[model samples]
Target: MEQDTNQNKVSKADSIRVKLYWRMAVMLLVIIVGILAMLAVIVTQGWSVYKRQSAWALASQKQAVWGLVNDARFKLEEVSNMQTELQVNLDPVFGSYIGAGSDFDQLKDRFGKNKGQFNASLKEIETQIKALRGTNGDFAKLGAAVRRDFNQYDRDTNKLLNAGDSGEDAVPYEQIEQDMVRTKKSLSALKARLDQERKAMGEVKALTIEDMARTLSILVGVIVVVIAALILISMFMIQNFTANMIKPLHESVRHARALAAGDLTRKLNFQPNRIITENSEIGSLCLSLQSMSEHLNAMLRQVDGSTQRVNLTSKEIRTSSR
Candidate 1:
């Protein structure tokens, strides 16, 4: 009755083999999700970096400022050429010798031509000035200053031309020279600003590329760390699963070998083992080994009892014969 009660106390385990398969499936799912997540980040971040590098964003910056820099440069060149031609035409008209002589028609012709060309050049310069004033803040202010100085010089030049070849009331060329000096300084400031802005744009583009590289490097590092962690976890789980499944079978085998050698000792028959209450296939195997040991021990005990009785009866019969 005690043995039967003890047998009833042991609960059977469901198959652990199936649990092992499930664990493998879960690991595979984790790997797949990790891959997909990494791919998603790569695609999204790479596209964002590509756009930032110089696509639509840089194009808009060029349209707003960089293109104007080139335009201003070309216009400045045209202004220089026109100013040189104007100076060349007007230089002789202001000569004292020409005023004292009768080359008056030649002087008039040169003045008229210079005046007409200056008007055309002034129109183009005004357009350029408007663009300069509307763009960069410092650049605009410097351009305005340069324009004012050039205007002073132009006003004096026009006065000298209108009073052509007159020995009397002409502003000294030195006064006009001072205005051009100031104009040169202001134009230098404007050019310096353009150069600075272009340099800044180059630095910004380089920094943007560095930032993109840093962001991608960090992403790659994180992915590698996570994958390495998963691999360690998988190895640990595989080790644990293998131990749990294999150890019990080995213990059961040892018990069976002992029973086969006919060693029906208390250790094999009554000792507790993993087979007693396991919940998996190994548990069933342990239970079978325990049952076989139990039945054999019972049969061996009965045979010993009958053999003792027979020996006692034979001694009694020999005494009766005596």
Candidate 2:
């Protein structure tokens, strides 16, 4: 009984040691998992924010490009309107049929107020239009003619200004009309190219945003799966170790109580019980407990023998006295 009790105590102590290791392992696992989860969340959030910022930047770029295209188109339209007005002014110059006397004066006044803006638009339109026309067979002649017409118009305006005759428009009205028509065609072609570029840019921005969204979603999914897998693996490992450790402790407790109540047949039952032979701490403990159980068993045997001898000696004395 004493042997069993000593073995149970040692077994309980070993079980407690295993339990402590398992608990520490579980705590470490939890800490590691928590840190990993936090890192994943931080990474996901950072990626999400970066994606959103990229999308916003792309949108802003698209807006800026579209604005530029619109501004170019608006300037082209303004040039077209100016060409029309020039064509209207040419009528009186060609036919000598001046209808609205104040119209020419008013046109001159308007031109003076907007001359800088008009000249800048015309310069930009001329450059873009010439580039679109390219180096073709007949474009050279057309280009020469356009330059001559523009120069003549400038010279005539100067002459009229020097003469102080607001009524005398000196532009060759018929030739100017033809030049305006050609220029309008060129402007229209350039506008078409700008429109095409704007469309392409818009498509690129849309595709980029869509791709980013898909990638972000995939990243989020991967993160969630990884985190869940870690949690499950940690739980499984901890549970397996804890169960193995707790079992020995419960058995040792039951056996100890039985031995304390005088059951000598009680034994320390360890599951998957194998002899520990290593020189490690747990192995040493098991060896020590086995030795203690053997010593206790020998002591109990000696006590039993001593008690029997005493009983026999007392009976002999009583018999003699009788």
Candidate 3:
């Protein structure tokens, strides 16, 4: 019966622990989930910020390439106009000079200005191509083609300017015209290539950013699951400690109080499944209380029997004296 009572107390404590710990678990789970959620937000925001910064750098590089392409296109137009102007002046009707010296001098001045501008523009394009070397080899190839054609055009222009002193009619207009045509075609192709490359790069960057976000999302999801598992395990540990350790201590205190109130009929019931072992201090204390109760009850029974015998002896003395 005592063992059964102890088992019942332990069972009741476990039931209460289950109820109380559920409430505690809810509160703790909320706090843990909130913290994990905050961490996920911070990580996501930080990664997004980094992704934006990286994308911005790539965009700036593409913008630089765009600006260089525009500058090259403008320079190419200028060179084509200069070549046409030179061809018009080379005509015997338009360029009938006061002297051969003035004709050579004017041609030299015009060719020098055009050559300097074209060289500067070509150099800038080459530099941009070098910067985009590993990024896009096709761009560099297109840029090289443009440069080659422009160089050929420069040579033809210089030949015409040098040959001008011979006679206006002797200028190689046919060769200059062919070189101009080729240079213009190459420049147009280069512009088209630049536009296509910009669009492709934008698409690639967008896809890369999307992949990174997806990866981060997977990682955060795993972290959240692990954190939730840890929270549940911690809550179980707390419940176990409350049920096994605290409940046993409370039972010991209650038993001690009952003994103090002179309830010797009741025993300090110890169940086999209890956390407090018979070798423990609480176990010894319970043993002492049980021993004290038994000793007090035995002494009370002896005192009552002695009082009954004394009353019987007094009754006999009273009858003899009467």
Query: Best candidate, TM-score-wise?
Result: 3
Task: Please give, for residues 164-221, the per-residue lDDT of candidate 2 as tens digits.
Answer: 3454544454554555465445444444544555566566667667766776686677
**Every candidate's lDDT:** 0.61, 0.54, 0.66
lDDT score of residue 244 within candidate 1: 62
- Tens-digit per-residue lDDT, 201-314, candidate 3: 676577667766776786687668767876786687667645665655666688778867877556555542344444444444555556655666787788889999999999
Clashing pairs in 2: none
lDDT of 2: 0.54
Count of backbone collisions within predicted model 3:
0
Residue 197's lDDT in candidate 1 = 62
Stretches of model 2 off by over 4 angstroms after superposition: 1-102, 112-186, 205-209, 269-289, 304-322
Which one is best on lDDT?
Answer: 3
- List, residue by residue over 1-322, the lDDT tens digit for candidate 1: 4664465443434456567667889898878887888888778877777766754344345345444444545554554455454455444453521233355456546645554454454445445545545444565576567668767866775565555545546666567567656766766666666666666666667767786988789688869977997898799878877776667667777787876786775343233333223445556557666676677778888989999999999999999999
TM-score between candidate 2 and the true structure: 0.55
Worst 10 residues of 1 by lDDT: 268-277
